[model samples]
Target: MPQAEVDTPLDNAAVEARRAAARAVQTAFRNSGVHAMLEVATTRAAPAVSVTIPLGGTSGSPFLGGTGLPLPDGAGPLQQLLEHHDIHAQVTVIELGPDPALLVALTTGDDALRLAALVIERRSDAHDAALRLSGVFADLGITEDHIYVADGAVQVGDINVQDAITLYDVLTGQRNDAAELDLGDRWDPRTWRDVEKLAELMGPVVSKAAGEPLDCIPHPACRTCISSRPHRITLGSASPQQVLLLADAISSANSSSTSGVSPPTG
Candidate 1:
């Protein structure tokens, strides 16, 4: 018959129906967790955290409720879904959009997400690698059976619980002023090697104390201790290639969260 209304004209009633449908969909996405994650993932180079199709998340996807969320094989969810899954993890609070407008927008747009970045600041251990080592020693449990000096490296003869603790404090700055130390301007191989070496030296002490091997997060301290640096890793996706950041590298890498003019944040 007559191709049934392929080019139907819109009347006043039709226009109202269109508006209502559009409004409903918008309302569903507004202030939703999926929307919030989408907003943040757009800021980052990665969007897998927000989407389900290989790398595409819908604003109304039920997976956000921890029902059918697809966590990649190796890469886990990027801190945004931690609370949704009832997972307790350390989180770094972040503004949703550009400041001034950032806070206002998140507050008005998606108060449910609350906007934070939960990064891996710690490994799987009783406490943070350094903190655990430091605490064990401070508790007065370990002792050093002997001391060995080779190539200017101090080696414990037989680390008891207390001495292991001492080493962690000495290296990780648990008992020392670590925050004052710097990580240098650039993280060259030499710097990384030095940091690695220091961590290796310090790792054993703490391990003996805690009775397990451990490495602390933001190991920039390991570099400072070994290389005697004074420059911290200025991170942030928009941070300068080499900025003398007053804050930690984790803060610097959030280039998307930066104010202005800075480039290459995280």
Candidate 2:
């Protein structure tokens, strides 16, 4: 008698591979120290699939959400899943430090004075730091932007002592305006297309109070402070990075809602 038909070895391998990749992504997330959430989806008609991973939380300054993890460990497996299914996947990330707008305000012209005030407001303990910063800024007869322009090497007083260190740390925190991506090693034509589509969608909706629009979502509470463009997540409108930032804001807001954390004052 003819042997009963069974699943092909190739099919079995593919299933096993998908499972392994998913497991790897989960493991990576756990080890990455980033508080993030993941979602998986498969589109109709094309049978294409995708994964959405949002990373970050509000551990640093409020009103400012930092750029999330650099290249998360889950990226490799996430990329594999994208290629295996010949579909799209987005790793939405949350910045873990200060908000983009705060950084902008501090690094720009007089915005640093406003940010310094806000910093003191948020963290009353920072008042002394603010005072010291003011003295240094006043003595140098320069704006925070000038200090940043000088690469934090400008001397205000006692060039080799504690004053410089304090100024450096405070200024350095605000001067950071770098962008981070998680495209991984397996991106192909499809991934690039997806990313470009996301960028187009996100450009108009995201908002930044000071500099260019942040490529991420803003927290609902942050709406009061940050000036964004309506905060809508129109598919293909926002890049994966923007969505990730939005996700971080959403998560932080949710957590705050539950934890009784106070919202930003100004």
Decoy 2 TM-score against native? 0.19
User: Candidate 2 lDDT (Cα, whole model)?
Assistant: 0.29
The sequence of per-residue lDDT tens digits that candidate 1 reaches over residues 1-266 is 66663433445654454344334323233312233222222221222122111223343232232333333332344344544644433333233333211011221112222222121221112112222222333344332233222222222233422233333443343434222223243333344444434444554433332333333212343444635532122111111111112112223222322343332311
Query: In candidate 2, what are the lDDT values of residues 1-266, reduced to their tens digit?
Result: 89985433334544454444444443333322222232222222211122233333332212122222223443454334333443343332334344211111011112222322333333322223223333434443323311110111111122211222222223223121211322231112223333333344333332321123543221111234324211121122223333344334434433454566633312
Considering every candidate listed, which one attains the maximal TM-score?
1
Q: What's model 2's lDDT at 134?
A: 35
Whole-model lDDT per candidate? 0.30, 0.29
Name the regions of candidate 2 deviating beyond 4 angstroms: 1-12, 36-50, 59-266
Tell me the alpha-carbon RMSD of every candidate: 19.7, 24.7
